[model samples]
Target chain A: MDDQDQQLVFINWLEDHSASVMKVARAYTLNSEDCQDLAQEILLQAWRSVPKFSGKSTAATWFYRVALNTAMNWKRKDKPRRESQQPLIDINVPEPHGPDSSERLLHQEMIENLYQAIHQLPKTDAALVLLYLDELSYQEMAEVLGVTENSIGVKLNRAKKKLATILNGGCDES
Target chain B: MNLDEYRQAWKEDEAQMNITFDSDLLSKEVLRSHQSFQSMIYWRDFREVGVSLVMIPLWLLLGSMMSLPWTWYLTIPALIWIAAFIFVDRSRHPQRPSHPGEPLLFYAKESLEQTEHQIWLLRNIFWWYLLPFCISIMAFFVNVAWNSSDGLLGFSLLSGIGAIFLYVIYSAVYRLNQTAVTEQLEPRRDDLQRLIDSLERETDDENAGDIMELVAAISESESGCGACSGWLNWAENWNRLVPSWQTATAIILPTLAGALCGWYSGTQLQIPEMGPTLFQVIVGAVIPFEIVFFSICWSSSKKQKKIQVARDEEAASKPEDRIKTTSSDNGIRLPKAPALVILVLVIFLGVMAFVAIGAFFLHMKEDLNAHNAQVIKRSFHCTNRV
Candidate 1:
């Protein structure tokens, strides 16, 4: 694709699918700054990858592939530095604004707990869980992860059980 | 809440998580990052190739300026070979394909392949990187030295020093690369392999039997069965007959002591006609010193065996008790006498052996010299009388 075409497609795709990018980045990083860093990296990689898009898979699937791969490799390189740095408080927690703000706050807390649990999973499992929480089908998850659909079922089942256990205050097996 | 509720909440929260980017700025930043990434890869390649590029011309310049022999030009081919070899090897194992859009397995496998190729390049650095340079450089030095005024002596001295210097440098380079492979690349490769393995592992019960068989095969190969196990056990028993430190000390300490003693005796205790040379005394002292050292080792080994047997019995009788006994529980034992006494005895024996051997050889030489003189005198006298 030409630069102009690539830019147009990328901006359009970002508009529609920026949620997946943010979710992936948040799942991979601890705090907002790192999440933002990872998100930007994922976007950059996605933009660079736009020229290679063959329309073989859906744009969401292709973008998830780029984002997750970028995040995985980034985490691998950043692990030492991340491990050394003290985790900053997450600043991206949503403020409850509606009249049923109490209920919304509870839901927000649950989501926070869920993200913490997801962080405790192995990188692949964490990616699988993110895709699952995003409501991707087993086929899409398999495509993103490069595993068979059956393997996805097995792994996702295992990851869900592990995530539930972590949520329930059980030890992480990661 | 159920997972469905959580999923709903998660999707609902995406609206609250706003990530706005200015498209123009984003494009610019990405373009810059892409350029930087491309340059980083190019920079790495340049770092590897730049050394040869600089060195080849520099060496040529040096050779011409120094008026080195025609053989010095041979280094050009050798240097080019090194550069070409690096370039070809690197191109053959180009950086992992940047297809981030591909599956995780593909990326991981590519990363692993790149790491393995790096390891291969480093592990065999001697063949491609060091040896050719070593040979070509040494050959040039030898040729220059040969054509010089002093000839063989000059050649020997210059080449000997050059060889030592080259060895130090090449070995250090070899070690650094090997260390990089071991400490960095190998671990990275293993991590990638593990990730790939986890992704590719089959969850089907049909493959369970194959995995079990593979595990069993590995275990059998490692532990061995029947006669092989017996021999391995026997070898293990003999291998630790004496503790490693004890064995090393027994060998190294005595040799050092014998050499020191021989050096002292050869230099200080010179008997004009009967004194041994340093080399001869060292040979003589080393023989006796080794014998005495081993005798001490044998005595210690016997004591250790007795202690081991007692410990074994104790362990067998109290299998339920987890705490184990160690031989060092008794005491730290050295050769029965004080160190001073042992040293004195060792020195005495070594010196006596050296003196005896030296006197015998010196006496035989003296006698042969006298007989030759006497024979010459008799022939002269007979000639005069005739």
Candidate 2:
């Protein structure tokens, strides 16, 4: 209804979704500092873009779209051209974790494995996997990707298999 | 190891994470970048101001010289030199065409060609008009020196008329040959107009839509946009008449007083039957000031009238866009006393005129002494006459 109302809603949405998007962003960024920077950048884009949202898709879907677009474009453009290269973090999963913390460590290792597997996939497939993980409907994903829902469905199926193969350590290099 | 495990961990991290940010600090960076981007658009105009300042002295010097009552011999050559310089300047550094529809790589080529075509008309002012007039003036001076006043007067008038004729000719040539130059120039002008329009667009709380929408609404307004509005502002209020008036006065007043003094003093010197020389001194003095005074007044009045029309057009513009409450400096003072102030001004002018007349009388006496000395030296050398 007004600027203050819109800003409050945007901030609330940003706070709720920031951690989820930050983890996705971490999969691509190399270090703790880069992860923090990427997360802030995503938040910034969401702030600027919220005023223009037509609401054809859910807010989460729009957020995922902007985040993925910003991340992929940044990685592609920034990687070799920029001199300051900070590679992704090497998160070490310690042996069998502490006696009481084995489950949490195992869960962290699985998430790390998912991130590694996603990185090995082509950019478009990786984006598809990330959107699917965010639980965006096929139609909502289509709007973000600027493609048909049927096409998104097809891409998702192919991406899932690629991701599966990558996770299994039998990923096709091509 | 599985999707469920990854999902569960993601849920855990999402729930546990809490990040703090100071938005005002972050937005300051964003605002800084926007300001940087906005500042770039004015770089060219800033350069133009610098260039114009450099040209001001040169323009004033030439303008004053143009008003001098020296024999046509000196005036003609000076005009020619000025004409050549203008031609060279126009030819070498034409006004760059600032806009064309972009297919990016080809845009430069098309715009460059348009710039060239624009300079074609510019060249007409320099070469065809100014050059021919200068040459004709020189030719007239030579004819007058050879005892042909009728020929000199006829050719001088021809040269003056030729300047206008050349401008018309060139304008026609541009119309026929370079229609695209005119069309391409319009959009660049429009872009400036749009920028000005956007600046003035309402950011008031009552307005709907985003900044972009506000910009669009402003573009659609009857004032026909911001850049157009600025042009209207310039065309109306900034058509400076006073500078030309000052220039004309400076050149004319001194020379006119000098000529009348020259004639009166020369007559007193009793130069045997040289009525024409005395008349020449008087007419010469009066002609230059009259020409300069009348020319400046005519040009300034023409510009003023044109500006008045432009102002009227701008006044007709009604921007229904919500008015932005800018931090307007209210202390800008309008000049008081208006035309009535001229009563006091005339007193000062009269005193200056009297001083100028006195100076001219002194200069005329010196001229007479120099002439008598030359005649005495000639007489001493005339052995057969002695």
Candidate 3:
């Protein structure tokens, strides 16, 4: 495709699947401003790399690779934002307002806490955990992460147990 | 919480609101970042070339003041070397294709190649950089010696020794840089290589031409963790040749004894000039090494004393006086030449006195021996006087 055509195609691709990019950036960064910055950079990189696309893999596969690598690079380069900076905006995740609302709120809190725990992880481990949470099949994970399909089971199990420990210090017997 | 249950919620709850980027600005930003780095490298090279140009006249002035005809030739090669250094530095760093859009593999490969290039330069630096300079310096010294009528044999011997010493130091530094590269940067590069290879293996695409280009880019550098130590640090802790060299008894008494032994040996030799000259040269080389080591130790100890006194006063003083002074505001005081250096100087003067007396004695002995050797010749001399 011509450069303009490729750019248009990539933007359309981002509009459809850019949520994954956001997930990766949110998993990596601590604050909204940093997340927005990282997300923008990831899109910019994905757009720039369009010329080199071999097209053997689906755009989604390529996007994940680019996104994960960009997120990893961002984490590597930037220092942690100073803690004394204002505390993170509270998740005003819709106050419980109906039957079954309490359980939904609890699940929301758990997921928020899970993201916090994932961010605490070393960047590589965090990347693995993020892929697992995205529910990609082990074979798909292998393709995205360049791990053996067999090894994904072991890695995911380890990441899951670590996540469990991080979530509640492994006290949740269930 | 089992991770599988969270997947649906992760997809839904963490779904981000739409964000947009202007296309034109981003492309410029990436190119701008790359350009900035290139500019930095160019300026650094320009500064080095400028500094070398500035120093050329100073060297010529020195040569003229010293009335040396040969210094002009030396200056030309020195200027050429400065130019060559800039050229090699520029040419060695081939433009790394660092377009922001390139794969992580591209960057990893570039880093690996850059490190390898550094390793190559550092290892072979003696051959390409130092050898030519050494040759020119030896030629200059030889020419000076020939003009002055110094014995070629003695001059050659000293120059040969100096050449060997220079090579030994250079080789040692090269090996040290090499070891650091292998130990520190090599493994880091290898880890990166393994990651790249793993990614390639899964792709089933045989485009490992990137890997093949690595052959073109083969090199490494020790970022910091190396075994080299400063001279003072080495002497302070690693020195084993003379423990007493740091103490009053060792230096003072040995200074006197070395002088006496040397003077006695000179007097005993009776060969005018050669005996005393030999003693002076040996002592001369050793004295510089001794004086530097002594000064480093003396200066360090004096600083420690000053610090101790400061601490004691700080302990006794009110909080305001005891407020630790900022290093810049308190100014780093240069250490005075210790009384010990003066004592060493005195001992050196005494040794010179003894050496002079010994030389005089040798001359007197040679004169007397010649007078005694004359038999009938002396009687003829007396008759001429009458």
- Please report the candidate that would top DockQ against the real structure: 1
When summed lDDT is taken over every stretch of 10 residues in candidate 3 chain B, the lowest stretch is: B220-229
Runs in model 2 lying further than 4 Å from the true structure: A1-3, A75-99, A171-174, B2-5, B27-30, B36-386
lDDT of 1 at B312: 51
Lowest-scoring 10 consecutive residues by lDDT in candidate 1 chain A? A81-90
Of 1 and 2, the candidate ahead on DockQ is 1
Tell me, what's the RMSD of every candidate? 18.2, 21.2, 14.5
Look at candidate 2 and give me any clashing residue pairs: A30-A87, A30-A88, A30-A89, B193-B227, B197-B226
Per-candidate TM equals: 0.63, 0.37, 0.50
Q: How far is candidate 3 from the true structure (C-alpha RMSD, Å)?
A: 14.5
TM-score of chain B of each: 0.50, 0.25, 0.45
**Preferred candidate (lDDT higher): 1 or 2:** 1
Model 1 chain B poorest ten-residue lDDT run: B210-219
Pairs with steric clashes in candidate 1: none
Ranking by TM-score: 1, 3, 2
In model 3, which regions exceed 4 Å deviation? Answer: A1-3, A29-40, A74-108, A120-122, A135-143, A146-161, A168-174, B16-18, B37-117, B137-184, B193-386
lDDT of 3 by residue, B1-386 (tens): 55556666776664523444455555554444335445544655666566667556755654554445472358557667866775777576853334333344555566666666666766676766666666765665555444433477866775666567667876787778778778865765665575567344544332321121121222211100011112222233322222433444444555556655555655665555443544544364346446754775676568767976775455334222211111212122221234335345656665655454445435434554565567558888999999
Error of 2 at B127 (Å): 24
